[model samples]
Target: MLTTVRLSIIVMVLSISGDLFSQIRNNYFSASHPYFNYMGRVDSSQREYVRFDWPGVRVRFRFTGKELKLYFKGGQRNYFDLIVDEKRMGVFYASGDTVVEIEGIKGKGPHSVQFIKRTEGEMGEARFYGAAFYPEGKLLPWIGNSTRRIEFIGNSITCGYGSEALGRDEKFDPRTENVLKSYASIVANAFQADYHVVAHSGLGVVRNYGDNQPVSVNLATMPQRYSRILDMDDSSTWDFSSWCPGAVVINLGTNDFSTKPHPDKAIFQRKYEELILKVRNVYGSVPVFCLVGPMIDEPCFSYVKEMVENFKLVYNDSNVYFIGIPTELLNDKDDLGADWHPSYIGHQKIANFILPVMSNILKWNY
Candidate 1:
């Protein structure tokens, strides 16, 4: 009789446990759902998936658990970073179909997670399926995102190509690039602001990075695709009405200066001014700053200065400003990212110089 009673007790406990575990399985929310908050060029469609291809784009959501698993698919090999409860855990490389399981989280009641795509569109697209929580956990209510918004528009530097390398000569890999540490990201994070990075590698306003190449065609330039979705498929336009940024940072022209067969000064300046006008039209008097970078040479910096001055004249706009960061800071042996790009340290050097200027402009404390 005691043996039978013991068996019955075990069976009843398991039945109750099974019902509790089922709650976690039933609580998953798709990426297309509103529970997921996206930044940058992530597109949600009726097809039940969210596709993101740009570097520095991010997806964030909340869950109640000590373990979380990310379900995702990518058009090609891709790398993404995870930040749980405001701390960066690590990067995940997803090549085939799989679940990125993050276990043993340090929290108790609830946790916040942000999946950040580190590679640019050159690698291919990444589609987020959804996320799963641990046993008996569920989703949290959505309060709005953190702070003011800033949009960064530029090229390889902004994409943070080769920024994760510790050594100077290490070859570039998609897995070694991290946009989360780029200068754009660093400054935005300092301000506790949401940022959008619209960038592509080896692309510029007038031409791509190549030696003695032909002049770029109409649609080949980065500016042509700036208004598009995921920086691809021109037919799918990015509605500017979707989100408004308090400031827009322009970081182009490095590729144009570094690449051979560059355009004449008059032509480059005209194109730059035209792009600025188009930006103003879309953003409507939003503060625009030309972030002359810690990459290109003095001549390029001169060009950026002239372009910003010229545009401000056209609109008589005081909101337009020039932020010049000398490229010489990266000349030190320890400063190079990889293939001479800015590493996390190099990005920090630039951020330290520029962030203070931005804080002054916005009248911010930090």
Candidate 2:
């Protein structure tokens, strides 16, 4: 009798375990699921997973669940912000192949979840293998993309480098680089638009920040990098036909002028024009706003203004316009982030400065 009782208990336990395992399997959803909505430049070539490195890339989904788990594989350590039902829950880090869990859900009904990449592409590429939910849960249709689209091609400013840092003196750490807080993201959000950020810290149109090289030998400049889907991989050419923006914002020249021995002024102008031409080549007369900064003034400001004017005349494209953000835009004492980069507050100010120009040009309200 004792042996029989033990056998019955063993079988019951195994049966329950099998059911749980089967339930988990049933609840798993692939990253390529049609219900998943992705924003920014993402490579979804793989059926099982989606890869992205650009900061501000977002994946959103709605599902009926009380708990959620995300399966992600990171090329290196990367951080992402979790938003549940339009509220930020927290930041989560992923490395290697890992499962991130969000439990203690308050409701039994369907909930929305969004993951926004906080770090720039140079930090690492990440692959999201999709999400798993509670046994009874399943994915629902995601909110569709916005009709308005904007593309920002810039440097560290667009990347939101150090936006979350405690102070201006603080050094840059990938954990504090929240691209969602950058001016590019803020402007896009304000306009209720989808945005793609093609930016890298210290990169420029010709000479990178603190680099003395001439234009001929300069490597990995914005023009070259802008066409890439992945920041770190040069071979991953982005297909422009897949996505096009209603407007393009270019904020370069800060890094080029950050130090002495800047690239030749003529070369800088030529390269800058070339970039605008490249944008026109693919996008076809989209409004291109060439921005000068709150960072460095004078030469960069003047250079960009002249370049845009010449570009309009030469290309006979009146859609290209120049907008300058004065140096006084940021309060040096309170608005500087890590290593004197723009803090979240600073980025907000920048966005405000550009918003009106964009609104008037694009005829977009709000």
Candidate 3:
């Protein structure tokens, strides 16, 4: 009787294990799968993959499982911040193989996660292959984005460089930055609009921050890499044809003028206006708002406004507009992030100022 009981127990255990294995799906999805959310220009990778370099570019997926994992391969060393549900998780460096699975969410759950790249474009880009889920895992469909799309183009400020750090003097680390916490993301989210961020650190419209290397020897600036998917190289071009934003916000020239005795005012104004025209030609009739920063003050600020006025009048373009963040907010040390960048509250302050401006301009309900 004891032997028979033991054999019966073994059979029950085997049955349960079989059921669990049956529910497990080790399937790898195509990189182009709609379940992923991308925030920048992306290009098709070999076979079934997608790659991007714009800081803060990432993917989101939903699954019904107790455990979830991601598969990715990155060049050089790359990092990403994981947000499970809405809670910010730790940052993880990408490994060549599958990452350890995230399990036991509040013990067990059907969880949603957003994987955001925390590094700048100059550092490296991440290529995501797919995700994994266990025990009845299923991928939810892509979150449909019905609102008018908007694109923010600029430098580190737009990239959220050091936006999460505590001190103004704290050296900026890629891990401390979150592009989603930047003013661009804040404004986009406030208006329920999908956004594309094309930004890098220390890059400018016509010059680089503290680097005086001639164009022949220096890295590409914003205008040069404007249409490229990867910021480092021209390996692939962004198919602007695939998606169109109703408006484009440009916040540049900070790096160009970062050094004392800035670039020639006449030349800077000309190049700035030319950049505006280029954006107009690409997006076609989309309102182009020339944005300035809280980092800028006084005479420099006055110069930017003058350039905007000239661009609008010169091109006879009524759609081109100018908006500047309040300089007073820049003095608020508590709202400052690392290396003199804006913190989360600082970003919110800018977003708050522009939320109404965008709403009225875009005809958004918010």
Greater lDDT among 2 and 3 belongs to 2
lDDT string for model 2 (147-203, tens) is: 999999998999999999989999999988988999999999999998888888988
Candidate structures ordered by TM-score, highest first: 2, 1, 3
Write one digit per residue (lDDT tens) for candidate 1, span 93-116.
655444566666765557888888
Top candidate, metric TM-score: 2
271-336 per-residue lDDT for model 3 (tens digits): 778787778777888988888878766545766789988777877878888887767865558788
- Residue 271 in candidate 2 has what lDDT? 89
lDDT for each candidate structure: 0.75, 0.84, 0.73
- What is candidate 1's TM-score against the reference? 0.88
Clashing pairs in 3: none
With a 3 Å backbone cut-off (N, CA, C), the pairs that clash in candidate 2 are none
Clashes of 1: 0
Largest lDDT belongs to which candidate? 2
Candidate 1 C-alpha error for residue 285, in Å? 0.9
TM-score of each: 0.88, 0.91, 0.85
Runs in model 1 with CA error above 4 Å? Answer: 1-25, 106-108
Ordered from best to worst lDDT, the candidate numbers read 2, 1, 3
What does the lDDT read for residue 154 in candidate 2?
91
